[model samples]
Target: MATSVLVLGAGFGGMELATVLSDELDEAEVTLIDKGDSFVFGYSKLDVMFGREPAAAVKLPYAEFTKPGVTPLREEVTQIDPEAKRVVTDSGEHEGDHLVVALGADYDFDATPGLAEVDSEFYSVAGAEKMAAAIPEFSQGRAVIGVCGAPFKCPPAPSEAALLLNDDLISRGVRDDCEITFLMPLPSPVPPSPETSEALLAEFADRDIHFVPGARIA
Candidate 1:
């Protein structure tokens, strides 16, 4: 009998794992499942947030992917039985020889008191698009890029947003009018690498972007 592998949340990790397993092991049955029908790259979200690309242009449909021994299913995962190697989804339940769970982190806006009430959150696609639309109308004010919590995915995203916002304001000829501030709980922008952090600090200083270290946004 062929070995069956079940994978959840067809993100980058899930997709790559399924593809590699299917390609390498011909007799293996790979089932890749996700709640959404398509995949969107993280960088694409930044592009959309910065008004560099539209949302439609960044989505890659899973239906277009063709791989032997690999099956892609769009279903919401309701439960997971890790010991039994079984998964229950909205459509049905499935049992497999191996189960891989790669579902990424979920953002909780209510975790912060006033986060949901804020104008935008660039972490999500919808929020990014909304902020992108609002960016053009923002003529003069303090633009704060902050992380509500620590140990979030993509540590460099906040810094990237600050630099991009600076570029956008400069392009609009309103750079001087807008003050950009980036807040993080880390002692430095990139704590793992001191050289990289120094480079980032230099860039922030040159661009007149305020860097608030060891700070947390409420």
Candidate 2:
């Protein structure tokens, strides 16, 4: 009997895993599932937010993804039985020899008080698109990139947003008018690599991008 591998979520990790497995094991059955029919790169959100790329241009349809021995299914996962290597989805239940769960983190806007009403979060695609539309009208103001909590995934995202915002504002001839601040709970921009953190700090200083270390938004 052929080995069956089930992967939950169609994000980068899931898709790569399924593809590699299909290529390595010809007899293996790879099932990749996700709630959404398309995949969007995390950095692509920033591209859309900054008007560099449209929302439609960033989306990669699952229907277009083709790999030998790999089956892509769009279904909401209702339950996961890790021990039994079984998964229950909205469509049906599936049993597999191996189960890989790569569902990304859920962003809860309500976690921070007054955040949903005032500021836009670029972490999500919807938020990015909404901010993209609003950026053109934003002539001048204090643009704050704040991390509400620690241990958040993608540590470089806020820094990238700050840099990109500076570039966008400069292109719009409003760079001098707007003040950009990056607030994070970490002591450094990127703790793992001092060299990277130093380079980022230099760029922030040169661009007049304020870095608030060991700070978190309430």
Candidate 3:
């Protein structure tokens, strides 16, 4: 009998795992599930946020994941019954010999007060689109890009936002009239890599972006 596997989520880890399993177990049936209709990568997300890439370009369709032994299902998994070896979704219940949970990380904007209400280009795709649309309208003044909290999904995204915002200002011919500030709780712009840190610092200095290093926003 062929082994039945159910993989939840279509994120980075999940998608890779599913593909590998399908390749390894030629006779096995693998089902990939996620609540989201499409997959948007972390780096590609920034492009959409900056209005450099259209939303459609960033969305990876599930239909394109058709492999010999892999089945892609679009359904919201509501609950998991470990003992019973079954999963329940809006579509129906699925029984599996093996189950992998890979729902990915969710954004908690409400963790900090005033964040959910504030205009943030980093949180949601819709939020990014909204900010992108609003950017061209603002002719002058301060464009404060702030990130509150640590261990966020994408670490370099804030710095990228700062750089992109600076580029946007310059392109609009109002860079001199506007000030871009990066608010984060890091000692360096990029925490993991020293080279990235130095490069980011130099970029910040060159672009005249105010860096609030080690500063926590309350």
Candidate 4:
């Protein structure tokens, strides 16, 4: 009999896990589940916002993935009983010999006052579309790339946005008229890698982008 693996949340981790398991174990039963039918890769959001890729092309449909021995289930996960190695979703219940949870991080914008009202986000496809429209209108002004909460999904994304914005403004010929600020809760941009943090800081200084360490978005 094959080992049953139930993987929750079809994010990067879950996808890689299921694919690897299916390839490695011919008899293994792998089930990948997520509420969303498709995904826009984290970094791909920037491409859509910056006009590098079309919104339609960037979305990868879950149903199209043809990984052998892996079944994709699109359903909402309502309950998880780890002790029993069971999970309950909107439509059904599942039991497996092993369970893996890779439900990615969600932004808590309410943590920062008035952040929800700004409606300026590049994390989702819709948000990126909005940014695509709004960014071009930014002739000259202060742009703040703030991380609302600590331990964000992609720690380096905020820095990337700040640096990208600087270049974007320069391209628009408003580099001198615009100011870019990055707000991060951590003392270091990439705390684990000091070298990385230093390099990003140097880029910020060279571009004249402001870095606010240990700061709250509020």
> Taking the tens digit of each residue's C-alpha lDDT, what string does model 1 give over 107-205?
888989988988598887888899889999987999888888888878888888889999999999999899999999899998888998999999999
Q: Can you give the lDDT of residue 96 in candidate 2? A: 92
- Model 1, CA-based lDDT: 0.90
Question: TM-score for each prediction?
Answer: 0.97, 0.96, 0.94, 0.93
Report the error of model 2 at residue 131, Å: 0.8
Give the clashing residue pairs of candidate 2, or none.
Answer: none
What is candidate 2's lDDT per residue for 50-88, written digit by digit as tens?
998999999999999999888999999999999999999
Positional deviation of residue 212's Cα in model 1 after best superposition, in angstroms: 0.3
lDDT values for all models: 0.90, 0.91, 0.84, 0.88
Best by lDDT: 2
**In candidate 2, residue 141 scores what lDDT?**
87
For each of the candidates, the C-alpha root-mean-square deviation to the true structure, in angstroms, is: 1.0, 1.2, 1.5, 1.5
Of candidates 4 and 3, the better by lDDT:
4
lDDT of 3: 0.84
- Per-residue CA lDDT of model 4 for 1-218, tens digit only, reads 99999999998999999989988996979999999989678898888887778888899999998888899999999999999999999999999999999998777777778878999999888898888888889988788888776777778888888887787888889999988889889998988899999999998999999999998676
Which 10-residue window in model 3 sums to the lowest lDDT? 116-125
Candidate 3: residue 89 Cα off by (Å): 1.0
Positional deviation of residue 125's Cα in model 2 after best superposition, in angstroms: 0.8
| Pairs in steric clash, model 3 | none
